[model samples]
Target: MKTLTALFTAAALALGANAAFAKDVQPDEVVKLVNAKTIKSLDELKAAAVAKHPGSTVTDSELEDEYGRYIYKVELRDTQNVEWDVALDAKTGEVLKDERDN
Candidate 1:
């Protein structure tokens, strides 16, 4: 029936969206790239982020390739309990964005 067809369509769309959002680079590949000096190591980037936000602890991190450019994103919580989102250039360990989460 039309109702069943609509349900299947909705399910397909949901799965497609999930797949798009699940794009991520493998950790070992990332390490290999860093070793080859193609990108800065995650540890160096994390250290830079920690230095930028003194007394903050990193909670999560991710590496992404967008438009052929590698970017590193990190989430942190400061001593005052404020959440911060930081983006860094994976190639040079530069800070691209540092924003406080609402």
Candidate 2:
């Protein structure tokens, strides 16, 4: 039983480590995702958001394929301690998921 438990623990750790790397996004697909939405450019999104919400900053973003569509992962926070994790549609500029950060 002790040996079995040790093997199980090792397996779990191995799985956890493998999950750490971020998934790859093909360059062409990424452009299609952004262009289809009429986003034009990443700088445009940043500028618009900053203008709307002063003091808030977008820290990081990534494009991912999910549910047969592209999703943009956006993370931001403001002086008021408001944290935002939003997933926007790559083809439509629609908000797919918006959650308040804990």
Candidate 3:
């Protein structure tokens, strides 16, 4: 009985540690994802963009401040290897800006 209790305690502690490491995204920020059809995480957002524009692959992804709003910057290259940038609301997954790379 004591061994079982100890094992459970250790497992709970490990789970708590993992939770602490997880990103704590706010509810209002995550609510913006409701508009997107198939996007939940930053990676998913990039994949959706590539899927929309075939032959394109993500080249760079970063968090940037634009016009007083925090956004995720995603750069992709098409089959021709032409590059473009897509900016998304970091919290809500909404597209804020889309422009071809010059």
Which candidate's TM-score is highest?
A: 1
Model 1: worst 10 consecutive residues (lDDT sum):
16-25
Colliding pairs, model 3: none
Q: TM per model?
A: 0.76, 0.56, 0.51
TM-score of 3: 0.51
In Å, residue 86's CA in model 2 sits off its true spot by 0.9
Q: Give the alpha carbon lDDT tens digit for every residue of 1-102 in model 1.
A: 999999999999998876576456788989899989999888998998888899999999999876567888899999999999998888998899999988
- Rank order by TM-score, top first? 1, 2, 3
Clashes of each: 0, 0, 0
Candidate 1: lDDT over CA atoms?
0.89
CA lDDT, candidate 3, residue 23: 49
Candidate 3 global CA lDDT score: 0.69
By TM-score, the better pick of 1 and 3 is 1
lDDT of 3 at 80: 88
Model 1 lDDT, residue 54, Cα: 96
What ranges in model 1 sit over 4 Å off? 1-22
Error of 2 at 97 (Å): 1.8
| lDDT at residue 96 of model 2 (Cα atoms) | 63
